[model samples]
Target chain A: MNRLRFAPIPAGLPATVPFTGPETLERRRGAPFRARLGANENGFGPSPKAVEAMARASADVWKYGDPDSHDLREALAAHHVISPANIMLGEGIDGLLGLLVRLVMAPGETVVTSEGAYPTFNYHVAGFDGRLHKVPYRDDAEDLEALIAAGHETGARLIYFANPDNPMGSWLTGERIEAALSHLPDGALLILDEAYAEFAPEAAIPRIDPEDDRVIRFRTFSKAYGMAGARIGYAIGPAELIAGFDRIRNHFGINRTAQIGALAALQDQEWLERTRLKVGKTRDRIAAIAASNGLRALPSATNFVAVDCGQGGDFARRVLAQLAAQGIFARMPGVPPMDRCIRISCGPDHELDAFAEALPVALAGARED
Target chain B: MNRLRFAPIPAGLPATVPFTGPETLERRRGAPFRARLGANENGFGPSPKAVEAMARASADVWKYGDPDSHDLREALAAHHVISPANIMLGEGIDGLLGLLVRLVMAPGETVVTSEGAYPTFNYHVAGFDGRLHKVPYRDDAEDLEALIAAGHETGARLIYFANPDNPMGSWLTGERIEAALSHLPDGALLILDEAYAEFAPEAAIPRIDPEDDRVIRFRTFSKAYGMAGARIGYAIGPAELIAGFDRIRNHFGINRTAQIGALAALQDQEWLERTRLKVGKTRDRIAAIAASNGLRALPSATNFVAVDCGQGGDFARRVLAQLAAQGIFARMPGVPPMDRCIRISCGPDHELDAFAEALPVALAGARED
Candidate 1:
């Protein structure tokens, strides 16, 4: 049979994905993991209010979600002290990243992101045929200055930075992010990913003017609010750029239950704060475990910790594989130096206990290998 | 302040959508409608079992859905008698359509679809910079032969044909679609949208080999399964084409609740059959109401009936507006001849009674104005 052909843009596209979910691993191993800590999901679970709201809205799943997500947008706007028009909700920051890439970068256009930053964003850029210019991270955090320089040097149409960065949870101050924005190329747009913002210190959040068209900040329910599976995230930026999403976005893409659950999650700030405390405690506990194992824990402002394995990326891969083999799911950074550290997500005590129990054995296995 | 620059493709794209959803209409009107028949969403709702599954899964929303969507895919594969490798699920048909257009058609490549069928598909083609060649509908249903001709003439890379099509609710037998496949351009893939397949007669569904690389059939939980708001849909095709989605898709885009709900919905075939019967009854009732109003109801093989207004597009528009004013939401097609009719969705008797009661007055209002 003749094979169906792909367009030139997709013809050379790699089948390689940035990260595979633990569910895939479970399927391959033909067993469920003892604890799910890899994906940085909140095993502490969502607020009771959010769960109830979702249960109530579950039957309404037959009705398409409000295309504008007005109720949720209104709630978010009120939370942010901005107008609803300044915000656009999508299937998650991942989905919004894809749309933002589509909105800002044409085929063959240049985009700049940190070398060790989010691969999903890079995936979107490459998917759109945009040329990526990546600057390596500085001290585990996204190097804003180098990113801006790369953008300027390449005349890049897009630049991205994630605060409290993933894989290695390091963050810079909001003042640093603000100071670096002016260095961006005049025509370039900055995508400030704050997916982990809820767990970050207040000082880490930049108070950018919502009307600032030069930057679009992304936030998600997946991380701090514990609604990753809901696929609800939003972008806050200038009204015009935010509205431009409608031109290409799947208008009814967001589900009704998600809209309701996210709204309830946002409203239950008390639970959010409680989750924050839990995450912080878990972070500290993981750090203590790393110290006991003669490994160093990188400072983190997110829901995960990166433990330096005192080795290289290859060693980290061995440790990760051994951990997975023991049914404890964890991930590590993709690049060198950073890849030397294995990342473990903060979960409930039992999950962390499983990670702690499995780590030493996994480490021994890695050393033996 | 400088405005963020859009990519050349998005820049060239219009800041307009084919259909402004009823939620948007409600927002613009500053009031909610009494009955919603505009979007063709199943008002009868989803299966209780599906809803229960979603509600149960609500607390786990913090964990992102499995990127591979393995379990759901396996279930879908089993149900369809195809390998799990042959299925790919996404946010919805709209999301999948965008990816398909991106995968096959480069800028300026030709694509074919019915002149007035599924505007969202056309929107995607234009958004991706594909040149669309349209063939007019023949007798209210999509003209398969003409679409094939246009596909061959223009060397279109993609051809879209929806069985039990929208706006007009007309259909062609599955055997006819299979016969028409011979006329498709050799390498050009066909997108067989079976969104309303559950309501369609079995004869209208073809027995194409699941492994055939020549075409992809899109199935959605949105219509017959009654889960539009869940935003879950899948495409069935050959392994290679199905695998290609991993190259560019928002891997975690499918919401957790949606995955759970869709799985349960698919499992409960009894509910699906009951809903199909309910839809048939509602369709018949809608047609009867149209006949009583001295309008001609087109032969419908889907969940909605298109009632000819016995006039032109202008009259149909007027009728639609008057219905909106009376808090009854109904829509009409966009193109010329098809726009002469008003499309009403199948709903519970109470909702249909509201539409039925409002139709005559709305028609009178249109005639007067």
Candidate 2:
């Protein structure tokens, strides 16, 4: 009776978050990290025009955002080759994942995902009381065949996959993904999370058939667009399933500045391309640095590179701790095999330089333990 | 199934929203409304300082908000004279309500509220499969005694009452509310949504002991502080219950612009007081306008006034539609007796002047029908 009682799902869950942000580390250490090369965020920042738009909209923040988010959706639709009806924008991909889980997965329903994947999606499934079935990665890539097989076997209402996937920075070609699509079970929605799609090679993004009701694709401004702080991301699917979000989403949850910022960001395709190129350059630099430090960096099509430390999860943890102690913010995958690597995001040159200098010293310090 | 499937909790719920934005109406009508005074937003807008902060942070928009919303929560804690652990911020009260209902209510558990209170909360309860137990309003005011009695009788796990309540704009003294609190079930949590508390008279606010685990208070910057578009609201409660949100909330869901705008908004109490005065003046003008049109305007402690249309829900609906058609947006209650009144928000002189000019013609149009 002393503790406030929670429902069964919440009661069974831990208070731990999926990832610790750099801000949390700063508070704990009482000093800011010299480099923020984790969380796969676009540290190079958003376009100046988008920043100006956000500032202009800031004074008018007292009013509620258009619950419909008409303008941004229209802009996003045009930016991608999709209809606005195919989109359902939310707080972020994290928020959209929560809604998708809620709309499709009833309590005790089954959900399928990789053994070590985006924890937020797993968190959503758990929140909605859906039982999860995880498939292990096949040679560092998400095992699509296993995911489809698991979804069919479990009759999962949801099967989640991140293209140009996080943690391992591995991805499969669009043709392979399209071929794997046939194996998916009917009534089971495939959540193709493409949060890092903009940074991915062209072939990594499939031609999403508008009529495909069984698959929904997600994209975020948080990644290549460099607007994660704006918390805008959207899902693309058939009209009926996409429209289902209207039943439960916080109608006015989209912030006004986010709407304006995202719209402007979408219009600035040049900036997006530049950021993508910069990310590719940074990824190569990170890989080279890892090689010089005797670590193998996994091939990455996204903003972050996963460097294999030739060790286990515990060794990666020690290396991560050592890096944190040296005022560098980095992260590693959770769960086995994948945890043998540390993840570093593409940042501005200075931040990358900081990471370069710290990696060797941190590795030495970690080895001393 | 040809029809799209929904989760059990969301099944059978209407695919309708409580309020439609003017933009949506514009899309339907193919034209925009000229004057906006419907949703009780501050047309006076957010502070210049806030807008500047948001603009400055826009470039950093690619970075995710601190999942913990550490800075804002600490600032809010300082403002409210409580520890950081006592506060939990969400997208808005609307989002928090959804989470709270999910956290506390099991399927079919009873929740008590005024019959025509905020429908968003009701929608959330239904989304979580909670049975909503309603109590009729007493003389346009939330019937607290009945709400408390219903909670005790039905063993309701949660009870909601809004101070300076919405729609009818009626409120009771805080001391009376405090006295009625004893009637609630011992284990039931009382959610006092104080979204309009900033504009309410001093006596309307209860001096609750923050350590009381049984009560949680919801406050928003959306109204008086003019940051509704920012989507920032916080709940104050005992540490145990507040921490429970961490277990399920989209930790980084709050956008960066919102954090910056709200922080600046909080620091400017002077603007808030000015807004209160403006709201008061505008409310009186709305009442005078109602009197000139031969309708009775009810007293209000909130930013909006409910003017009796001398008819039923149908007549008020007609009046509202007529005004909306004429480009003066307004709304009314959805349920009985209270629905006889059309709600008008306080706006700048020009916006209210448009309402003043539009009311009689709209009333006449309603009379003809």
CAPRI quality level assigned to candidate 1 from its DockQ score: medium
Which stretches of model 1 miss by more than 4 angstroms?
A1-3, B1-3
TM-score of chain A of 2: 0.98
Q: Give per-residue lDDT, candidate 2, residue B306.
A: 97
Q: What tens digits encode model 1's per-residue C-alpha lDDT throughout A1-369? A: 253777887888899987888888898998999888888888888888999999998998888888889999999999999999999999999999999988877688899998888989999898888999999988888888988988889988888989978878999999988888777788789899999999999999998999987899999988889999999999999999998898899888998888999999999999999999999999999999999888999999999999999999999999999999989988888998799999999999998898899889999999999
Measured against the native two-chain assembly using Cα atoms, what DockQ does each of the candidate structures obtain, in the order listed? 0.71, 0.71
In candidate 1, the residue pairs with backbone N, CA or C atoms under 3 Å apart (3 or more residues apart, or in different chains) clash, namely: A226-B62
Off by over 4 Å in 2: A1-3, B1-4
Residue pairs in collision within model 2: A62-B226, A62-B227, A63-B229, A226-B62, A227-B62, A228-B62, A229-B61
lDDT per residue as tens, model 2, A216-244: 99989888888888889899999988888
True lDDT of residue A186, candidate 1: 89
Model 1 lDDT, residue A231, Cα: 90
Model 2 chain B poorest ten-residue lDDT run? B1-10
